[model samples]
Target: MKAYPITTRYIKRGEDFIPIIIDAIRNSGIKLEDGDFIVLSEKMVSTAEGNFVDESKFEPGILAYFCYYWSKYLWGYALGKLLNIKEEKIKNLRKLPKKETLRHKETVIRTVGLRYALKPYAEGGLDLTNVPGTYVSPLPKDPKKWAERLYNEVKKEFGVDVVVMVADTDATYRIFKWYITALPYAINGIISGIGVLGFLLGRLAEIFKVGGFAGCTPLAIAGNKVYKNYSIDQFVRIAFICDRVHNTIKNINEVLEKYNSYVITEEILEKLKHTPVVVVKIKEEYIPNR
Candidate 1:
């Protein structure tokens, strides 16, 4: 499989991202072909979809405080080892400042609920990285809509057979043929709403290397893969390819450290590259004459 990353400027909120992305792909000098796949970063779609929240406006309740402590203690201590999460990451979680982060935890509790609020970072896929101060980009309300629009728009521009996927950096684990993820939502194929346990169990297995792959999962899919009835495993492999090619998995913590503050400013963003779109060409041999 061959993958190409289409680079674009930081896609801010209120921008017409779909047209801009298609234009980037057009200018990228790569030709879209039949059976190709287009993978989009969920952050880009969610931001353009206007999902940013002013977290400063939300107050943390008792439940939010509990989640904050839970994240600092449980995930920072025991759960991290069980999942074999990085020791440095666990240390950071342990040292999370209540004064700086409690409000965000409360926001998660109120915005999504206790289920996602229980997890440590990327809580329900809500993140502050690459976003402006006191603002977070929540999960897109309708990922399928984004994927469908991209599918149609790309075809309109390039006139080729292609599948469109809006995807996240989060991984989905396969167990006894059941594909499950910690994500609050997923596309039609992978399972969702499993919450913290999904993350724990999946990462536990991942620690020991359990699945054929564990990288990224599609939030929603459209076009050729839907018509072909591609298995969840097949689709996930495609997402993994796109994710690794771009390899933009810098967590919010890293972003915080780089800027020395919880708030990621526009000056910090200038130092980073945003390639929210990837065009992929898969070899039929990846699935053996499918």
Candidate 2:
């Protein structure tokens, strides 16, 4: 399958993103075709919808401390290694300063739940990267509705039918025949709602020789596509491609280390190219029981 990345001006909170998407497609020089797949970044859409949350606005309490303990002790010293997490990350987790991350942990518990609090990052898909200070992007409200709107709008603009998928970098892992995602709200039959248990199981499955982890989480699919047209396995493959192409998107930590958190403004972020939209061509059809 061939994939094309569309670049547009950085989108800010509450900005109208649909027009930007359409404009990017128009300038991309890649014609949208029937049966193509259009993948969107959840971060971009959530930001456009003003779904970002400031952790500083929240208060950390006892339960948030427990989450801190989970990160510092369980994940840092024990579970992280078992999950084959990188040593540098484990070390950072062990050194998590309560002063810095406590409020964010509180926000995670309040927004998602205690179950999601067990996760180090991407708790219930309230991911904390690719944004300016103290902000997290939660799962977009009615993601499928958003996908349908974008699909209809794209079709209206281009006069071509296409599959529209909205996905996040938070992962969906596979073990044997079972598919489970780190975050809830994954669509097209990828199981979720188990909280971090899915991540634990999918990682541990490697030791048990059952299965291993796989692609990023796809939250919504529109145009009666994905599971209806393509096999779930094929769709998962498509999602991974989108995630890889999105590497052009920078992590906020890049600037946080060089400059003060308060000084790393949106203008500096605009210096980076964010590939929030990727269009894919399915070169081959999935054959049943092939």
Candidate 3:
């Protein structure tokens, strides 16, 4: 199988994504054919649909305060150490500020419920990586619809019958064949919304082999018979690889420096190759092996 990262100019709110996808395909010089799998970064779709929140406006409630304190003091120092989490991450969690942390926790609680709000960064698929300022992108409300729309548009534009997968960059834990993720839903056999307790349990039990970030909540897979049995490992590998390609700015610090407004302007984004779309060409002969 081969993966092609399609580079395009920055996608702004209210901009039609279909045309941008067509342009990216044209620029990549890759011919679309039947059964080709198209993977899209969920952030791009969310941004286009204006599915973002101004985190600064959130007001912390009692539950949010408790959750913040528990996560920072208890989870960060005790549970985190028990789970063997990275020392740096543990330290960062312990050092999280009071007011800001409470606001962030509150946002998570309101967005994905109290259970999902307990997880680490990118809680409930709310991400702050690419977007500027205090603007955080949430998982698309209806990913399956977007996937179907993209598939239809691609067929209309290029006469190609391809599969579309919308994915995020949040981590998912797996035990043997069982895929456990923080998101509430998944397309394959992935168990979702297991929360922080599940994450810790999975780690302590040593059942998790690949603990890296998986795709987002509501991963939408449309069209193509080849993806019927696509495993969790395959999805995680592809999603993580594609996510790295979508990170136009090498790191968060660079993103902040380049776009002080926090919102990446079309002008600045145009100069960089923002690859939000990836085309994964699966080899039919190796389907059984995969």
Candidate 4:
């Protein structure tokens, strides 16, 4: 159950993740055991795959309208309420320049769409929270394949079986109700009637005094469980902190420091300074046994 942070070597635009993972494991001195697991943040994989999209590339169209109104009003509002997004920012969301506004708005839609259409298991907070610019990215296409590849690679290099898990920082909840409507892909993985159900259930969980982080902690655990045995060449989506799904992974630093007391060493910082990847150990509870 040891959670190891593998900071990748600053991966190039098209660099594959296999080698970066290998380097991280090697540098961290994490000798894998038969039951050991590797938890990978999907953002790292998305960056490796160049899954990002420039908001500037979007053209004014129906899709833009959907983002501007539907996402901003629905998903954004709900999350803003939960995360306490600044009122000023929420207000400003409505007055964005046509194109930038559309891109940001559409980013929400596309995020929601991916959640619903592609991975029903993904959660909300998939929108742009942390990145260098105005761009959004979705979960990788073949997590199972990527997981398999990483598993094989780690096994070959280290002579120990390691489960590969692709994770995001989004929070998730259980389905509280059923729906018969279609959601936009922009909001695909980020919002849905399913999420609405989860949201409601989250509220109920609170009222009932259930122990949870608004149902997100359990959902992240489920993502890890579901992908425990995915294809060797595929990436297995795994445990994530619901709060990490924001505009960037930068904020993760603070969360990591809060939950994990391991100091960021000078060597680690130096490596991270030059590489998109980093390597460190998180507390064991965050790691999955499978």
Q: What is the lDDT of residue 11 in candidate 2?
A: 86
**Runs of candidate 2 exceeding 4 Å displacement:** 224-227, 248-252, 258-264, 284-290
lDDT of 2 by residue, 1-290 (tens): 87777888788888968889998999989888888889998988898788988888998999898889988899999988988887877877886767757887898888888888888766788856666667788988877877888899999999989999998887777788878887867885788888888878878887788876677788888873444866557777788878887844334344456564533457666887878999988864534455
lDDT of each: 0.80, 0.79, 0.73, 0.44
Q: Lowest summed-lDDT stretch of 10 residues in model 1? A: 281-290
* Clash list (residue pairs), candidate 1: none
Q: What tens digits encode model 1's per-residue C-alpha lDDT throughout 120-236?
A: 877888877768888888788888888888888878888886888888877778865678888888877677887887887777666666652355788887887543667788878
lDDT of 3 by residue, 73-190 (tens): 8878797787777787787678666766777788888887888778755577776656656667778877788888989889888898988989877666665556677776666677
Candidate 3 Cα lDDT to native: 0.73
TM-score attained by model 3: 0.82
Clashes per candidate, residues 3 or more apart or on different chains: 0, 0, 7, 57
